[model samples]
Target: MLVSAAMLLTLGGCVTMSGDYNVTAVDANGQPIKMVMTSHGSAIYSSRNAFCSNFPKATVTIRDFHTGEELKSESPYHCR
Candidate 1:
């Protein structure tokens, strides 16, 4: 029983799970302007001056890289 407990503890360290999302902003030319990886939804943003200045009508997309699912998308944001 002691050996089993030790094995369980060792195995626990190998168990890893991540729920990270990839946020990307692209210009009208389909060029990636900015990208970020985060675990929280609130960390994503749609507006960026550097990206939007070059491509005023840029698109921002967020996807769950782990699950291969798109979480959100926005376009035609106002940029200064």
Candidate 2:
């Protein structure tokens, strides 16, 4: 039981809890234009405005930190 408990604790510590998401903006040629870190979808808009001002036509994609899943995608000009 003690060994099981110790293993559980060790495994729990290894689990990552980071919720930060990566917001990447790429140009029409699929070249990276900008990158931002945010925790949620709503935050992406503000981050987009800040990081992607010079690349207004860029395609923006939000990805999960751990799973690398594409959570959202939109154009910088279309973001609110």
Candidate 3:
């Protein structure tokens, strides 16, 4: 089980995001369900929007790691 989990994580990748920000998926009730610490670089988080579809009332929030600036928030992703 441990090996399979490791293999899956290796192949699946982390959080489906990459950038210098805190990316989080918030559920309808204003609870963070998924979050990832991205590497420092240009931002590209297109897949984060999918959480809205999957969770229906979910929101995807991207914030600057250093300054705490909110960089993004789309249609279905309204954060608390």
Best by TM-score: 2
> Using lDDT as the measure, what is the rank order of every candidate, best first?
2, 3, 1
lDDT of 2 by residue, 1-80 (tens): 99999999999766333455777777766687645666564665676676557665567777786788876434334322
Clash pairs, model 3 backbone = 59-77
Candidate 1 vs candidate 3: which has greater TM-score?
A: 3
1 versus 2: better lDDT goes to: 2
Please, what are the lDDT tens digits per residue for candidate 1 over residues 1-80?
Answer: 99999999999776333346665577776777755435454444422344555567766666776885876343234343
TM-score against native, each model: 0.44, 0.51, 0.47
Q: Lowest lDDT 10-mer window, candidate 3?
A: 71-80
Top-lDDT structure, candidate number: 2
**Each prediction's whole-model lDDT (CA):** 0.56, 0.63, 0.59
Clashes of each: 0, 0, 1
Residue 34, candidate 2: alpha-carbon lDDT: 49
Enumerate residue pairs that collide in model 2: none
lDDT of 3: 0.59
